[model samples]
Target: MKCSAPLALASATRGRPREFDPDQALAAALQVFWRRGYESASMAELTEAMGITKPSLYACFGNKEALFKKALDLYERDKLKYIGTALEAKTAHEVAERLLNCALATHCGASDPQGCLGVISMVGCTAEAESIRADVVARRASSEAAVVRRFEQAKADGDLPESVCPTKLASCLMTVLQGLSVKAQGGAKREDLQGAIDTFLTMWPRR
Candidate 1:
């Protein structure tokens, strides 16, 4: 994302005020939410990480919920780029391999915070954060639906066994993906996760 100077308020007057890059601030907020689940992330922590005051955060990004939604959008746009690529695989097995490999890279990246941000937010969510949980669930459902559709096409193209159920397969794959996130959060090694994925793929149904 490109960095641009913050937009000036129309009502601003008098001496010039400090300006911070909105894109940079949003990115910082994303890291905080990624490290700490949405509900557990404190407003002070968000502001401190974003390098902005609470008033500025509110003025630019609305409330915490709104900020989280924007951060989630950023995460999907950036971190989930491999998903689109995985959908383009020539075979169902290839698609599953790419998805699992990409997910492993993402969940266990050395420079990134461990675990999946969506998983953290959704799983750690409380009843008070029902709206946030619902939002994450809806987004996840959409992704799962895309995987299901892709698997259905694969079955139609004879890339998968006729006996395989696209919906169930999609669910199974996603369940493994989520489990990877949990394991990564629990400090599981990359080799261990890779081994598990290999085992699962080895057992994948064939035509």
Candidate 2:
């Protein structure tokens, strides 16, 4: 099994060297940050969750801020894969639909922690966490820019009405998506969130 391979590797290298799976450790760190947010996720919690010594964490992942950044990267790469796929959709409406559905599935998944890591970090950041907040905001801006570009292309292709402003439309969609994350974090039910998405989709302009 996959679990056995890691155990075997540890056994084989026992006397020779100390080793740990970086990916597994990072995944664990991601869980901690996702659940507790960057400011609230203490070094002790991260090290304990990651199953690594504090020295090992520092050696491998740097300080808390650095580790949180790495965890954010993993979150986007693994959990937000749908964003790229949504851009490939034939219509702007289809793109929005896919994004919303994927986000709903991700936010409400039974096995994973509730809400978005990015949203949680953004909301929970304190004055001391300005750098982390800026980083999250910058990353969000990049993603929003991508969506705006997609909407521009859709408008050019007649998949979206010329009357629609791509930037504003992108902003509006992003607002709803972020709102979903906030609501989910606050214990909003899946059905209620789905209803909100349904209402928003109904109001979305057609080509």
User: Which lDDT tens digits does candidate 2 get at residues 1-207?
Assistant: 122242224444434454678788989999989888898889999899888899887766667887788788889999998999999999999999999989999989966337888999998997688999999999999999999999999999999888999999999999999999999888898999999999999999997
Per-residue alpha-carbon lDDT of candidate 1 for residues 31-85, written as tens digits (9 for 90 to 100): 8998888988999999999889998888777788888988998899999989999
Q: lDDT of all predictions, in order shown?
A: 0.87, 0.87
Regions of candidate 1 where Cα sits further than 4 Å from its true position: 1-18
Model 1: worst 10 consecutive residues (lDDT sum): 1-10
Candidate 2 wrongly placed segments (more than 4 Å): 1-16
Q: Give me the overall lDDT of model 1.
A: 0.87
In model 2, the clashing pairs are none
